[model samples]
Target: MRNHGLVAFVITTAVLVPAAAHYLSAGHDQVVKFATATTSTLELAGAKIEARLEHPLVDPGESLRIKLVASSAVGKRLDVGLLVYGSKGDEDDRVPSPPVGVAHKTVSIAIDAEGNGSIEIAIPLAGAVENRYSPSPFTSYEVLVMAPRAATKLDRLRRNSALIGEGEGIPEYNASASKFMNLYSWRHDLQGEDATLFGEGVVARLDAHTRTINPAIAIETPSTTEVGKVFAVAVTVKNASRKPARGLVLDVETPIGVVDGAEGIEALVMPDNATFDLDAGESRRFQFRVMPDQVGVLGLYARVTCNGDDCDDDSALTKSGTFDATEIVKAQVVDEAPSIVGRK
Candidate 1:
């Protein structure tokens, strides 16, 4: 019997080790890679703008930034206007408001054979400065590089540009930018959990909410319980996104009626965009209590919010489903009699 138990244990461990290793390896491959690109004649302001953008990357706060250099492709002198729009379609208009915490300054440059340029402009992340903007999982913006054609000589005002690293005569000017833009469209799964303490005693703890592109709940029980007993519950949240998520909110609901002090405590607060940040490949735990008042089946639900405002309003944001709580029965009897003193 002992040998059979040992063999079973070894077999379980062997099966789980490879599974765990495979998951870890898959996670490692999901890290982001930063690259650069250049472009010429970027259409802007009803005209083509001659310029190049360098070292563009999706920033930590979920915004994009790049170094820009502009000049006239034509040898003739002309005025240049550059604008950054948040859409890919024809309504190419400047962002209604620059993302919060970003500083931007537009400068005029002379177009010479060598491509005269000015200092790089830095645009900060939107909605961060005033706490007004909500985090968005799918957002895009376009940089319009525009140069006016010479009034007398239409052919003299050229707006040719290329990504910085690509060598001269690279057939496609905007190929690198196009490729990077494609990457922006890819989405990833995210999952997380958190706990909060509420009601009379500090014994109550709520679980952290998990956020993922897919709506699902995974719960793990660490220990067993009896009926009518109060115990601690720990919840873990996982971020399964290919990219990081900001401003996360999680809520858990218990189906059982309040025992003594377990009422009106349904939500767990996570680090908001204003608070602690959860990076990709990260997980957090929340602890609370499960106090059973009677012996019956119990149900628990967990809802998650990520990268958006009004987490409770599904119309404006995304949410996950409920996680069912484990059921346990109450003790049959209680010992009430006292024992004799010193009677062993």
Candidate 2:
């Protein structure tokens, strides 16, 4: 693991062996060429604003920072927030407000008389993903600056823009101001032991084979159970690989009314993830108690991660089990036999 308060940088762009956990200090982007790197941008007449992340490739263990720069013939500013999304379209967690979801960090930028200025924001990796139990790797997040565009009188007021808006006071407003939006993305993967770099256009990827330990899990008992009944189910975790998996974790997702004992083995309650370790060719069974409230079949999911940190790939978080479950039939009482006897 990298120390939480150390300062580091990537000196080269060669293929790097992913490192363990580490931390980085501020002012990490010692060398940044803004205008040269941004091949795309959204700009207003005589002014252009672009947002760029310090590094295109980042370590999952460290925080992600973005620099918003603006240059123009005149001095102007915009209220802005960030939007981060996943490659698989994981949009549950985002920053700022809609269209970016709910986040509280909104900043304003002011350019100098020379028409150049910069403002930045740092997104801590700890809670970057809202409602996520733990972070996942091989996952790329798109970061963009979301600013309110001056579409209408109300929009310009809320956006706090100097630009004019229709129906407010000006006859024609600059609609382009409301439309200025650009997106940039980078991978959250591991790099050399102490540092992670955000390499523009290059994503550091780790496959399952990179992990020394091969792990698997399956339902070993109680393939079927009755609804509204308390039952015990077992899932055996196996290390199919020949090497030991350090800081291993089991990420299990099951429907409601069903619970697992896997909650603690050193666990983080949110997202329902667990952490542990396994040796070469080792197998262990974990028991979970289930109580199905409604009738019908329920689904089960499980995966083994060497630990879903920047150092490991979020492999096999797939459909591991789809066991069957049944519900008890309700019974109804019959009327007294007197009516039936008289009819007979």
For residues 211-257, write the lDDT of model 1, one tens digit per residue.
12222333333233565465444444566544455676544445332
How many angstroms is residue 12 displaced in model 2 relative to the true structure, after the best TM-score fit? 32
Which 10-residue window of candidate 1 scores lowest in summed lDDT?
193-202
- The all-Cα superposition gives candidate 2 an RMSD in Å to the true structure of 23.3
Residue-pair clashes per prediction, in order, are 39, 9
Candidate 2: C-alpha lDDT: 0.38
Residue 328 of model 1, lDDT score: 49
Q: Which lDDT value does model 2 have at 102?
A: 19
All candidates: TM-score: 0.28, 0.31
Per-residue lDDT of model 2, residues 1-344, tens digit only: 11113223322221211223121211212111100122234453345667665344333435556677767736566555444433322234332221222123557777677887778776643223321333322233445444333122223222432244434554332443333211122323424521122223222121110001123664433434454454444455766766666776554444222112211111111223446666778766554444444443343334565643432453332212222222222233477766544553
